[model samples]
Target: MLKAKAIRIREPGGPEVLELGEVELSAPGPSQVLVEVAAAGLNRADCLQRRGFYPAPPGVPADVPGLEFAGLVESVGNEVSDWKPGDRVMGIVGGGSMTTRLVTEGAELMSVPAQLSLEEAAAVPEAFLTAYDAVVLQGGLRAGQTVLLHAVASGVGTAGIQIATAVGASSVGTSRSAHKLPRCTGLGLTHAVLVEDGRFADNVLAAVPNGADVILDTIGAAYLSQNIKVIAKQGRLIVIGLMGGVKAELALGALLAKRASIHGSVLRSRSSKEKAELTKSFIDQMLGKLESGELKPIVDEVMEMADVRSAHERMDSNETFGKLVLRW
Candidate 1:
């Protein structure tokens, strides 16, 4: 076993509870690869996990709170052949990715695009993978369709905008901060709505008279009613986060009239087999766009791994526009 420094939460509380500490690592098993992590990406989920509100899925380290990493392959199990020592890669994990090293299934790792640095690659996996899975796979976003993304300045929202554009769809996005809307236009956002007083239904309908064909909602209860208001007939709404709150009142009549569908998704709880399939699909469909610079990682800042508490503070403040990356 090797000893490595990592961000560990001693007790559930606040950002102050996170601290740098040592962890023991085990050798990779068959079908796994050991990676020397170069950087890790921060997510709002990390904050939820730190507060003990969201626990890591079974089999992942309960104390470590990271979901994505980019690094070089340190070693591979006897059965692995797709990657070798010195290969640069990035991927998502249930937990433990905040450490300096981790063991993950070989199939979960994707070769880092030649144009991106390890820090940039670290920001891609969770944000882009989650957005792609929700908007394309579940929401069935297609060419020429209109997609409405809540929290457009977030890591996943930024990725969703680019993904929709890459697939020939038009996108409309909303954020509490008005300034964030301009930053989204360059990513192919057709319309930007600055939500006021927790209301944006009228603006969304005004921007796309036909209404959004797909709605990628990150805010839960607070926006559920508005989402139902602006969704088009036969629209699909994919809820990927619950930052606002979990419980919400639904209008069954509105849902029935629109014939809309709502799907709640969480990436960290998926089975290993499901994650592998999603990873493969992402690599096949989105890797080329990343390589060609059509889709790029939006990194708001890169902090040292030791400053995990500060990272968490920034995310909690909702002041960050994109991914907050942590370098080891």
Candidate 2:
């Protein structure tokens, strides 16, 4: 058995519940690899899990709350041949990534881009992967199309802007704060809407005229109706978070008239096989852009593993623009 320091939650309630302590880990199983974690990215889901709202998926360590990590390979199981000790990797997991070391299936890992630091790499897997899947694959965003993204300065929103730019699409983004809009312009945001009292649809429509071909929403119920109003014919609306409340009354008539589609996505609950497939797709599509600096991780802050509580507090306060990385 190997011993490592990890942030474990004694009982889910608040950021104060997170505790740093020693934990035991067994050797990797066949097809798995052991990684010496260098950094882990903080997500809104981590805050939700810490508050007892979102539980880790079955088979994940419920007490350990983290979704993405970047690290060096320490060991590999007998069945793993593609990766060996010393390989640099970054990837997403269901949980248990808030530790000094972790075991994950070799197929689930992505080789860290040569240009990125481990802290930068830690911010990529979750944000980029989620944005790519929603905007490109599911939303069927094509070149010259228009996309509107909520929470404009967020990790995923910044990623979407870059991805859309790389593919020759235009993006309009909305944020509650007017200050964040300026920062997003550097990421290729074509339009920035400052949402006041939940009014953004008019600005989005004004920017695009024909309406957005895709809407990537992090705020749920609060933005649903407005999203519907601003989406183009046959547009795809992908909801990946519920920063707002969950339940909302929908305008089915408008939805049908526009022939729009809405999808809800959560990466953590996906099966290992599904995650591996997405990771492979991401590598094929976005790795080159990442290497060439066309795409980059937008990190808001970095903290030590011992400062996990403060990290959570920052995210909870909604003051962060991009990812908050925790270095081990």
Candidate 3:
């Protein structure tokens, strides 16, 4: 086992409970690699974990909180032949990413784009992968189709906009902050809707009367009705987060009439094989774009991991336009 410094959640509560401490990391298994973590990205899920609303899955460190990291490969197990020491890689984990070192399956790692720093790379995996999986893969978004993206200024939101544009699909993004919409539009958003009172169907309809072919929603229950109202025929509503609330009455009649479908997706709880497959698919389809600057990681700010409390506070307050990345 290797002794490593990590961010430990002392108890379920606010950011105050988070503390930088030491933990033990087992040596890489036959198919694993040990990474010297340079940085990690903060996600809303991390906040939920800190509050005790979300717990790490079995086999993950229960007290550590982080979903993604970018770093250098320190060592690889004997059975790992693809990566060598010092390779720059980034990927998602179930937990324990906010640490000085991480041990993850070698197949789950993607090469960091040469143009991006590790800090910037830290912001990519969770956001881009989630958006790609929901908006493109599962949603089956095609060229000339339309996608509705909520929380346009968020990490996944920004990524969705770019991915939609890259695929020749139109994107209508919604945001609570008017100021953030302009930046989202600059990121290739076709239409911007300012959500009010948990409403956006009217504005989305005005922009695309046929309704959106794909709806990537982060806000749960609160947007269910509006989502149903604005879905096009055979539309796909991909729900990746439940920030608003968990329970809501579903408009089954309306959904049935449109012949649409809803999918609930989460990356953290997926099996290692599933994650590896997703990583491989993403690399094959999107890595070139990342390397060529066609797809970029939108980072709101980079801060020292020691100030993780402030990072969580800012995220909870919805003060960031994109990702909040932390480095050791």
Candidate 4:
């Protein structure tokens, strides 16, 4: 048995409940790869999981928690020829990432771009893949169009801005921070609106003047009604988070008048085949941006594996502008 250190919930409530301990890890299965985790990213989903609002997908151990990581391949299982020992990779999984070593789906792993550090690479998959699926796959963001992204300083938010730019689409990003607003602006976002200062609709519409061709939002029900007002004809609104609340009243007239569509996505709920497809698309379409330095992972805070509790605190308090990673 290999002893691996991990953070777990001992009855969830808050970050303080994240207990660190050593556990015995088993060897990889035929379709799995054992990775010595170099870094693991913290996400809003992590907080939800810690609060008992989320759990590992079926078949994953209920006690473990985490969704993504960057690491070296310690060993490859049979029939996994695309990777071998010593290879650096990043990938997403059901959970169990809060460990020194863990198992991952062999097919989900992607080669880390040469220019990226392991910790930075750890921050890549969940945010970027999620943003990619929303903006490109479902939202139909196109070149010469415009997009509005809420919580634009988040991991997925920042990723959305870079992706919008890479696809030749102009973007207006929103944040509560006047200070952190510049980071999104630095990514070539067409507009940076301070959400705390006022409503985002004005800034977003002012940038495009008509309305946003696409709205990539994580605010959920809080912005549901307002989103309907800002979306252009046949526009797309993709909601990926529900930080404010889960239910809202919608104006059916607005929907009929604009002919717009709303899409809600959760990456963890996807099937293995679906995940594989998304991973392939992201690698094929997004890797070049990383290689060209047009897209980069945003890492806000990094902590030692033992300090998982503190990492959770920073994320929960909204103290971070980008991804917070835990290094093993």
- Give each model's whole-structure lDDT: 0.94, 0.93, 0.96, 0.87
Q: What TM-score number comes out for model 3?
A: 0.99
Query: Per-residue alpha-carbon lDDT of model 4 for 144-257, expressed as tens digits?
Result: 998899999999999999999899999988887788888788877788888753467776677677788899888888878878888999999999888868999999899889
RMSD of 1: 0.8
Clash totals, every prediction: 0, 0, 0, 0
**Cα error, candidate 4, residue 260 (Å):** 0.3
Ranking by TM-score: 3, 1, 2, 4
Worst 10 residues of 3 by lDDT: 195-204
Q: Which of the predicted structures, 1 or 3, would earn the higher lDDT when compared with the native?
A: 3
lDDT of 1: 0.94
So what's the TM-score on candidate 2? Answer: 0.98
Give the CA lDDT, 0 to 100, for residue 59 in model 2.
Answer: 89
Q: What is the TM-score of each candidate against the true structure?
A: 0.99, 0.98, 0.99, 0.96
Using TM-score as the measure, the top candidate is: 3
lDDT of 1 by residue, 136-230 (tens): 99999999899999999999999999999999999999999988889999777899999999899999899899999999998999999999999
**Candidate scoring better on TM-score of 3 and 4:** 3
Among the numbered candidates, top lDDT falls to 3
> What shift in Å separates residue 9 of candidate 2 from its native position after superposition?
1.3
Q: Which order, best to worst by lDDT?
A: 3, 1, 2, 4
Give candidate 3's error at residue 72 in angstroms.
0.3
